[model samples]
Target: MRAELPLAAVLLTVVACQSPTAEATAGPSGVVTWAASADRMGDGIAGRSYRLVVHTSVGGTDLRIRLSNAFGDRPITFDSVYAGIQQEGAELRPGSNRRLAFGGERTVTVPAGSTVWSDPLPGRLPAATDLVVSLHSPDAGGPASGHWMALQQSYATQGDHTAEESGAAWTVPTGSWFYLDAVSVHVPAGTGAVAALGDSITDGWQSTTDLNRRWPDYLARRLQRADTAVKGVANEGIAGNKVLADNPAQSALNRLERDVLSQPGVGTVFLFQGVNDIKAHTGVTAEDLIDGYREIVERVHTAGKCVVGATVGPFKGWHEWDPAAEAVRQEVNAFIRTSGAFDAVTDFDRILRSPYDPARMLPALDGGDHIHPNDKGMQAMADAVDLTALDCDTIG
Candidate 1:
């Protein structure tokens, strides 16, 4: 038996005990290969199981998972969780499923506005593989936390079915991923990662589901084949999200720490937001938007990471289009193209804009919405990213 200490002393002791091990495991070699931004869930369900299928960007050993309750008003308890390779619809490959522990315990209770990482599972995870995370919450309710739009098909069911490897128990299909937000692995010493911080375009909206056609997904493929050391990719985009304000999701600035910087081995932040802020007719000026971008760049730089800024794409035909908003867009794009504040810049407006109109998306690449990009446009955006820009080693 041990004697109890004051709460503050106890907290300090816990931190002291955890820091050394964290520093060791994160030693210059580990990287987060995949991530999904956690947003406030619309509704909460009790006693349910979820098997989320996510595509990996880089292969490595000692795979780990991060569970978030960032928006919950109460603590959430996860009794069981498993990680494995996806064989087919909700089915895991034979002998691939493995149980995960939290702080040496099988169960973990995440407090509101907090996250917890599972102890690393020893094994090899291949790049581009469909990795599935199965989780069961004994009591999950009140402002649930998750990504609202996954752009992929994941399965859910009632009760404690997380330990099952077959698809039979997971009968309900879900478009959103619950609780689990990130997966990481131990890569070669020189490997690193990039976090794409943007809106629906970066979120793969309108792209084919279950195909891994997001621009970040394409970028991952490019990194794998290129001669660069930046091999990990984390897509942190939300549909209808804004850079300066919160609505569909928290503002990019507000969530940057949790969504971008906190991931292991992140070397750069890819900023590709602002269209929503300009089009909302919220009286946001070009200067206001530029200031937001500058803040993001400064904050990222302070964290020892590089910033890659992309010019806002044209949206002349969208419902909210107007001359005033178009003027703001042009001004913002000019700054993004000419401003040396960003460590690197990608001219997405130049790559996706129609040559004939110069103010609209190319017809062939438009996803019919004129605002979001089709698969071709998504691929084109990824292609335009200079693989070298993502491999900056001098920054954090």
Candidate 2:
């Protein structure tokens, strides 16, 4: 006795029933828990598999990975990718390995100067866990994209062995992280992250290898246990990087968008750079460096994020130090301390400088070269950060 519905009405009803939720259609709402700024590798390797081990800062479900081809002059094809918990050297925890796909496909071709994020793997990734990502590239050539100074030991193999859980095939030990750049996890809706944009000190140059002793790493550990909503951290530092010019790596100003602003769920850009610019003797004045910093702060503010400035640490014992450079360093630190240009400031110079001689670094913290901080110094820098300042929602 019921009347028949029109075909159009029936089709519309079916479509509505099959539609995904608003959140699902919008993509995974995840925050980056770990990231390593990418740099150009000396030479690219083809037909190789990489077992990259990275530490997570926050715990959450729905894990995702980011692969970068930023410096590649040609397209790179990744045939297979997997993620798992590390049991030991090149070995994965049993029953924890899961395959990752891009757009529902196992293989994805990333165009030159582009990046791709994988579909989320459903599972809870604990904070501070060693997450191992295995990826195989069928053809990876041209300028290789990776973090050259990982300060961690990752493994590699010659063929398509990404799904293997054992270490038998992964014979080559690599200090650099290849292709992979960022890792994300779905945390509570309000959780955010901070990106440390800096140089060798921030990049863990003198920090012990495979120990996660970098200042940023220590900061991440603190964030994990704290009650603050800012629970994620990304280390965007590059060894020998400068604020105004490119030395061995891209300048902080030039790579700001690619390394800091582009990261997911980042709420603050922690600027801890400029030592190289002052010591390089490149005729870069405090005005020039300040202009560069202002530009970065403006750009990040435009993107709706806060900026936390860190004073440049003292480096009087390095071979490049001179009176002119020391004068410039002092002038720049003065501005960083009183500029009101940043939302917050951390006086790393005060933290690492010797009380006896303000121009020199504390002997206990100096990592032999007097330029980079030792592991204890790294921890001190992290401890100096006010966690509440990182949770600011207003841009400055």
Candidate 3:
């Protein structure tokens, strides 16, 4: 079960698991949305482009791409769009590029507040490589969404909101690139999947925009190195998601089955939530947080799945971090390290916290928000994982 670390003024580190295996598998088919920005509150202007580059292993036979404007109120317009293989550090020019068609036409109008999957294209993918996709926008402001990875490096066209005359090219420096939506890679059968279920910390917020340095990415890299039978980690961390009923965006208890259990062939879960409830102003105490975690663990076990609990890290400087909340944080951390409700415990708090400053975060890991970790901080969190819990050969 799950356990927690003791309340002591000491630093602790543990080498719990080995490198994981990584192998590319067939991705889903039939209109998978590339990416969607549900909230369009941010700025969409010139020089602010959203790019996605997907890392895929060779051997896929068919591929396709799409664009999303799920949060936009009006139809999104694009001047140009292009897709091509990633070469060296950028997308290869038209000789290796393909034009995506919308309704048998090069340009298409995506209805407001919805997603449109791409029409399939005939293409052969190599094993273990990156696909760089890029997009551009002529108009200064438009609602947008972006996928974490794309195969094409540039998309350019005649004017804003116009895709009909767009052409696939080596490079277009004028228009603003929007975002890469999604891609479909054909894979052989019998491929397993990994899903990292957590909060915004796992959403790759502060990490370099497209470096693919998130912990789940790191875990995928590890698995690739080990030749594990698993495919890749589909990240399921919503920025504001939580463990209890406090978060309105669907709590962990409410979405567990859908986000974690309902996923296809999931072998492991890395639980990295609950700090929200502990630091929330609702007065939820430490014991209450533990009970909430316990309930989640019980449900995961009932599903015949292995669960790993990551101790809630400190948030002393957070807006809600008060003495009362700090006390609860300590209590919850202790329970996570010692309770044994989970099959294994990951000491994320210990690894990310400052040994010199017990009350605050380590300066290096702090994203300046004190509540979340930066790129280096995220790397540290990924480095803290103990992969042995997923070892069916050794796990009890």
Candidate 4:
């Protein structure tokens, strides 16, 4: 008699064969899922055209792709979607490319507020390459909602319903899919993983949907150029996460373990937290915040991983801004600058602050809120990181 695989077991075996373990991170031990989303209210209009840019470091022999509409109010219909390698910093022009899909077919219907991954495709990515993903719509669309994770390249297609051509090398148009998620790739062993843990800035709001402009994506490009061993980055930043409790959504401490420690093969941790903690109403004292930092540091260290701390930047217009908070900000900066707890430090304050008005934010970097950094500021944030800090030998 021959042994048999149960239905769920058969599904698991198929996923394993597609994604594989050596080229994958440790997790539920199966196919890696990818997705993205959009909304109608204030994000984009229904029936409007939109595009998505996703960066993947999964350089493997076999791969699969998925798009999401999990946030839409109605079923998202797709007309045409294009995938290819990015040429010159998200410029969706000509490059080595091909039309990708779920098992060699086109046109998919993703239910409202849901996700869809493509059947496995033979995608072989070189080290540190940026994959450009663009989508087109022929009708009024919904408010775009998707997280900025991956450490590679991403871009969005523009125009309302009749806008058609998304300015790609191709001229065809596709319907629309609200939720665009994961693009999993099969890989080999010894690949390094990136963990970008922070707040809304890292989460990517108002930064042009599908542009993939999150700072970590730039870091991914840098890492790819410098070391192929570094695979990809996992973005764990929540829109309102704070270092301490400001509110549940705005608290980084509340989600650190779930967001950072829980990620698979998190070889390095890059922290850009604490702004919300200080900006929260009735914020804690500098010493109190320091104690919180100490606790977080201990937990991260206990996980046998290295952490890079980011100093808080100037935020005079925040609700909690006051002499006491400013003083605390300086205190925290001093601690981050000198503390041996962190393996390295990235001074975002130094990168985006206005020298002309040191107390104010740099107009170019500030996203009109005088708090969150704009796309340019996000780029500066990525540039501030010393790529070598993620080197295994350096941390280990």
Best by lDDT: 1
Cα displacement (angstroms), candidate 4, residue 344, comes to 0.9
Range of the 10 consecutive residues with the lowest summed lDDT in candidate 4:
5-14
lDDT tens digits, residue span 28-74, model 1? 24799889999998656789899999999998877778888899999
Error of 3 at 368 (Å): 2.7
Instruction: Tell me which of candidates 3 and 4 scores higher on lDDT.
Output: 4
Across 140-217, the per-residue lDDT of candidate 3 in tens digits comes to 356554422221233433333221222333334322224443444444554444556677677666566546666666
Ordered list by lDDT, greatest first: 1, 2, 4, 3
C-alpha lDDT of all candidate models, in order: 0.87, 0.87, 0.56, 0.58
Candidate 2 lDDT, 175-282, residue by residue in tens? 999999999888888999999999889999999999999999999999988988999999999999999897777888889988898888999999999999999898
TM-score of each: 0.93, 0.93, 0.63, 0.62
Q: Residue 359 deviation, candidate 1, in Å?
A: 0.6
Candidate 1 weakest ten by summed lDDT: 7-16
Give per-residue lDDT, candidate 2, residue 130: 93
Q: Look at candidate 4 and tell me the lDDT of residue 143.
A: 47
**In model 2, which runs have C-alpha deviations exceeding 4 angstroms?**
1-28, 394-396
Q: Which stretches of candidate 3 lie over 4 Å from their true place?
A: 1-191, 245-248, 298-304, 391-394
> Using alpha carbons, what is the TM-score of model 1?
0.93
